[model samples]
Target: MTETTDYFDALATALLKGGMAEPAVSATLADLRGYLTETGTAAHEEFGPAGEFAARLAGGAPAGEPVAEAETWKWTADIYVDRKHLNAYGDQGWEVERIDRLGRFVSRRDPEAAMCWEYRREVTGIKDRTAMTEALAPEGWEVCGQWLYFQYFKRPKAASAGPAAVIETPPEAPGRRLFLSGGYRKQLVATLVAVVLCAALTAYAVGRGANVTAILIGAAVAAPIGGLLGWYAVKRDVLTGAKES
Candidate 1:
């Protein structure tokens, strides 16, 4: 068989294996054939390897799900840890599943990079924690994850009413004020402070001829306390911002 014929045959085999109906596969192939004939484009040049194309086409349907080309869906984990971004994805039918430790939002949809709001509050004192969560729950917000002292939540995308709803400003959360502001800058500052304190104590001990053993012990304790505080603060802020959407 010619390469073109071989390519289609492979694609046909793959489609069948991928659970596509025979009639639908035949129709798809017929349309592709006509496109190739009219454009005078080599199948490989226009469509790349047939196996790859077939696999990609099959991806839209997923296992046990029959999906139309117009309703073809894909997964995206490109969401940031924010409600606005999650909501934007929600608007388009994407759902936020979880946020990783590093604050990346994993969402599943039939689509692309999306923007939505995220709101977070640290599960600080019992009073703030209960009030914040109980308050947000009524406003279509759902908890996604809780890391350290942080509580993550997202607002689902608004339903479309004809023309896509202009993305709305994220709702305000009462406890949002508790979150530390600044992005990575806040974390960097905390880390820097820890390092500086450690270095300064070490330098002071050396210059003053202080007991090296005692100095090292002090440094070890001080550094970690500083570092942990910093780390906790950042984690708290991250979750707070993520939910604040």
Candidate 2:
């Protein structure tokens, strides 16, 4: 299998086995899929073609071209999470704490941006934490403690005089709502159809009467199994729709 396909399959399997709540797992998987798609598209554009790049590198050609490609790869692979929203909450006297994937905390306080700190004693990156902190101090941010936290504070926005605008919330489509709400009904209909089809197939096998015991057993086992699978599909779809909504 291709590297991308293998990575995706592994991620899917991990998602399936992970003990996270269903909604969280589904959202996480969706995010990962979107990231992978974007990454793949960027890689393809930069590398021209994966197969061509691999062949050229394998033949021990000049390393200059591949070195340039490596730099491009690194640029695209680096992912940064923006912390601007933390400042918004800070302005409201709400202390915000955000831990990145590496467990580095970013926090902020109210009304004192200069007192804010970005702790980096235990964190990687930023060779000179003190200098970094000093530079950010002007912007009401700082670093402090061993836990690598970035903190800041800001004033809240003033309230406006007129009436607040009415936000229009979109209504759910009728057909979509019906599909989501009729899970049990759909399952029942599918089960009945399976039973009828199994009965017909079993009758045909009996009419032949030519050592059809195995066929009968197979149909008996398959009928309920198929019906259960169909029910599961419908139920899962409905659950996913509800979660998304």
Candidate 3:
């Protein structure tokens, strides 16, 4: 019963967050509550995941219309895969409202297929971040959000004078992905080095003429390096294939 109530409450919150009117959201929740009461069914059994359900509702509506302050809006749950991914959607006329540890939500009134957006991401401190933003301002990427160590920036599609030049992703996307994924590669190398060092130490220690001094020295160096790498890998959640950094 508690889980069911929590699920519906979360769904209601997401709908409201997506730009549905309070009365509309309230009415939807009320309808669900009544249905559940009459049928005695679990919320998940009926509605599925709240994020996906909200996405379906958001998608069903028309988009790409110019919005007024009081105009009804719609939002969908978005995956956070660095700023490049979000920029691709911006190219399609959507804009990110906010993104945090929980999830990302982007809003659009009337989405246009021909439009494009560009984005850039960086990891830096306040001083460097300010500098980076200032530099990017001329190119048109506006700072959007910062999640953990990463900062996101975006800009609307650039206008083209030539007969509607085809819009495409920025040429730097591949390079950026390689750069971001490089951290994990370094950790992987460190992990492998640790394993090989331990193996070599084990072999030397068990040899016919084992040297205690060599074994001790190897252990001292290997233990710290291996321990540090292991701890970092776990902290980065590399095993689960989460964000690389």
Candidate 4:
């Protein structure tokens, strides 16, 4: 038998063993065949072993009770703390839906039935992100969100761990609304100081009947002064992290 046929035969038996009805099994195999043909890739390569893939599909659709309405939360963190917080919350069964307009993570968890999620952040340019997404999909990751050059991906832990994915004694919810690194805080302070300085200079110039061009020059000079300080703060933090790692 061909590799494709061998894979399907194994997948069909596994799906049936996993409680999929016969009709559904046949339809799934037919769809998979078409997908493999179109992509010019073997079934096992794209979806992994037949037994494991069937288990993932079965796990997502358990037979019995209705699920409770999901509880939702929105929160955000600076780049320094985002991954740490994301994985923490994901372990507690929070699945991030998207990053909203204000750059907050919108997440949900069904109290009655929730799956542990795993997340990772990737830094890449726009053009490479598509390739990155394609590469990750075969491993069951789906894009969670993107902000500037950062990309986030998530997958249920069940995809790899099967029944072991359920969390016991989940961690407490994070109390603080925002997570900013010391470096980010320094940057904010620097930027604020610059803004205040500029405003004071502009006001003082107007009071003394200074020319408009002079005020513009003061503003421009003060703005970059704050920007430079902020840049220095971030650069120092990045360097420190690199050294420690």
- Output the number of the lDDT-best candidate: 4
| Lowest lDDT 10-residue stretch of candidate 3 | 170-179
Clashing pairs in 3: 63-110, 63-111, 64-109, 64-110, 64-111, 65-110, 91-115, 91-116, 91-117
> Which 10-residue window in model 1 sums to the lowest lDDT?
170-179
List, residue by residue over 178-230, the lDDT tens digit for candidate 4.
Answer: 77776567667767786787788788888899898878986788678767777
lDDT per residue for candidate 3 within 136-232, as digits (tens), equals 8887776665544556776655543332423333222111212234554666687788779787867867786788777778788968977886776
Off by over 4 Å in 2: 1-183, 243-245
Encode model 2's per-residue lDDT on 1-245: one tens digit a residue.
27555544444444334322346446444544454454344434433344443332222223222211110000000011123323322232333232323332223222222122221121233355456556656655433222223222232222221222111231221121012224355556768887888788778878888457787779878977886787567445533432211
Model 3, position 41, has a per-residue lDDT of 59
Q: How many residue pairs clash in each candidate at the backbone level?
A: 25, 11, 9, 0
Decreasing lDDT order of the candidates: 4, 1, 3, 2
How many times do residue backbones clash in model 1?
25
Tens digits of lDDT, candidate 1, 1-245: 39889989988987777767798689668766866765466888867787677755554444345544322222222113344444445555544454443444444333232323344434545346557777888776666644445566766343324334333342222222122225544566768876887788789879999888998888778777877786676565554444333
Model 1's alpha-carbon lDDT is 0.56
> What are the RMSDs of all candidates, in order?
15.6, 21.7, 12.7, 11.2
Q: Residue 161: error of model 1 in Å? A: 5.1
